[model samples]
Target: MTLTRQVVSFSVIGVCSGALTLVIYVMARDWWSPVVANLVALTAATLFNTEANRRLTFGTPRRRGLAHVQSAVLFAAHYALTSCALLGLGVLVPAPSRTLELTVLLTATLVGTVGRFLLLRGWVFKKAA
Candidate 1:
């Protein structure tokens, strides 16, 4: 697929994944702390996002070991940003409203999405020579 097409596909997937994460967090928050809920949501979305990007966005039909590793590293970076946002919210507001928490998470996720796209396109899923 062309780079443009790949980016478009990735963006669609990213939106779905972000929405999924929010839903997961909302459902999980009832039973788990915000941090733990976010963790679970991120983990679930990462697993699906990696495979979807590999097959649909990057057009890597065959399984590549390095891709999985790269995806994990990408998620780690994303998680770090998200965790910091959560931490900062806690510190800043002490008792931030639920809407505020969700807003912070969505913003963090969007920032991470930009970085993730760069790494996925320019590094992890680069075209073979």
Candidate 2:
């Protein structure tokens, strides 16, 4: 059941994130635009991720004010790391078109995504002992 939930949860989130990525890429065309777009997407994902992660990923109830705040802070750090990577890729790639830039950024983002998921699993979304 847990594995099933994890797969389903990840799939849903992936689809949601993909949709946001497409919209953002179309709306903003530039080397660094995806970074900006990612920031926007991250904000949206945060809210969705936090709630979903707690219940589905960790079986954690909706934590109240202070715990929520703590989780948000941790999530910010995790998100910033990935966002910065994408921005750095934008600078490093020197791509001529937005499509090319996004390609580079997405490659970088893949590494960051794994890191983020591990961190969230081990730290942010872990069940209380």
Candidate 3:
């Protein structure tokens, strides 16, 4: 059950992120486009990511408990890391080099996705101690 929920959660968010990136790129060609796209992605990621992991992945309810707090904290950390990674990568790779821009975005997504999975598995969405 948890596995199924996790798969769905990840799938939805991943698709949304890809769509968001394409939209942002189409709308703006400035250096700020990547930043804007990432910010939007983080918003969706944080909300759905928290709810899915807390309620579905861990089979928890939206009640006041350690799980709730843990979920918020975990999602917050993910948002922070994602924002930093996207911003830093933008600086390192810049926007004119579309290849580098895409690579950095992909790398940041890969690392952040792994980190979120691990954190949810070991801490936020784990069996309550």
Task: State which candidate has the highest lDDT.
Answer: 1
| Candidate 3 lDDT, 1-129, residue by residue in tens | 557767677667656655565455534535556666566655555565566556545565445366557756755665576567657876665544755655666666667777776776687656655
Backbone clash tally for model 3? 0
Question: Candidate 1: misplaced stretches above 4 Å?
Answer: 62-64
The global Cα lDDT (0 to 1) of model 2 is: 0.60
Q: Score every model by TM-score.
A: 0.94, 0.65, 0.58
Spell out the clash pairs found in candidate 3.
Answer: none
Residue 107, candidate 2: Cα error in Å is 2.1
Superior candidate under TM-score, 1 versus 2: 1
Q: Over 4 Å off in model 2, which ranges? A: 1-8, 28-35, 62-90, 93-95
Residue pairs clashing in model 1 are none
Write down the worst ten-residue block by lDDT for model 2.
26-35
lDDT of 2 by residue, 23-58 (tens): 665565444355566666666656665566666665
CA lDDT of every candidate: 0.91, 0.60, 0.61
